[model samples]
Target: MNKVVCLAALAAALGLSACVSSSIPAPEVTMSKVTRGMSQNEVIARVGPPDRMRGQNGNECYQYALGKYGDVPFAVYFRRAAVVASERASCNLSITRATAGPGIVWQASDYAATRR
Candidate 1:
């Protein structure tokens, strides 16, 4: 009986923690400052490195995992070291041929959060 009660309390605490985890906001990307003529290094300095890269050479897609679920990805297309477009992708979708991809970039409920 004591063990069951302790387990129940632990579970409730965990649930509450997850509900409140995102109360701290993510760092915002100053995307408006990123311009077409800037070099890839310049963009990275502002928007940070993307979660994934979809192409090679100076032309490539830089995908940043964002939105509510974090599984939502947004890509900034660059050609010859210049920005072409920046757009959010469909929910739970990728523009690449990857058979599998990463989950939410940050998950409050994951086991890793508890690690020292």
Candidate 2:
């Protein structure tokens, strides 16, 4: 009976530890594993679900909140369900064509870049 109680306590402790650790996001090293040509499902599996999603059909964009404060925005562009490009920046930007080098626009105090 004593052995059984001890095992139960140990199991409970490990379960609680797992729950606490999972609440924190994975490190940057995990995010770095993401690469071009990876599928949308693959990216989601690596980084978890995206915080924001935009676009439709062939052109799709998914934004994830990163960094210690969750302030850094990471955008991954998908073309035909495959990753074409990924960008990390202070301003949230979305482009229809991930391969295209579009102009970056800046406004006074507020930075308003191209978001589509």
Quick one: best TM-score, which candidate?
2
Q: For candidate 1, write residues 1-116 as lDDT tens digits.
A: 99999999999999999998856234244446567677778878877887877544455567777645576566666656677666666212233212122332322421121111
Count clashing residue pairs per candidate. Answer: 0, 0
Candidate 1 has an lDDT of 0.57
Worst lDDT window (10 residues) for model 2?
104-113
Cα lDDT of model 2 by residue, 1-116, tens digit: 99999999999999999988875454465468679999989999988898877654535677788876787778788777788877774223336343323343323422222433
* Global local distance difference test of model 2: 0.67
Report the alpha-carbon TM-score of model 2 versus the true structure. Answer: 0.57
Per-residue lDDT value at 102 in model 2:
39
* Candidate 2 RMSD computed on C-alpha atoms after optimal superposition onto the true structure: 6.6
Q: Would you list the C-alpha lDDT of every candidate in the order shown?
A: 0.57, 0.67
Model 2 misplaced regions, further than 4 Å? 1-27, 90-94, 97-116
TM-score of each: 0.48, 0.57
- Candidate 1: worst 10 consecutive residues by lDDT? 107-116
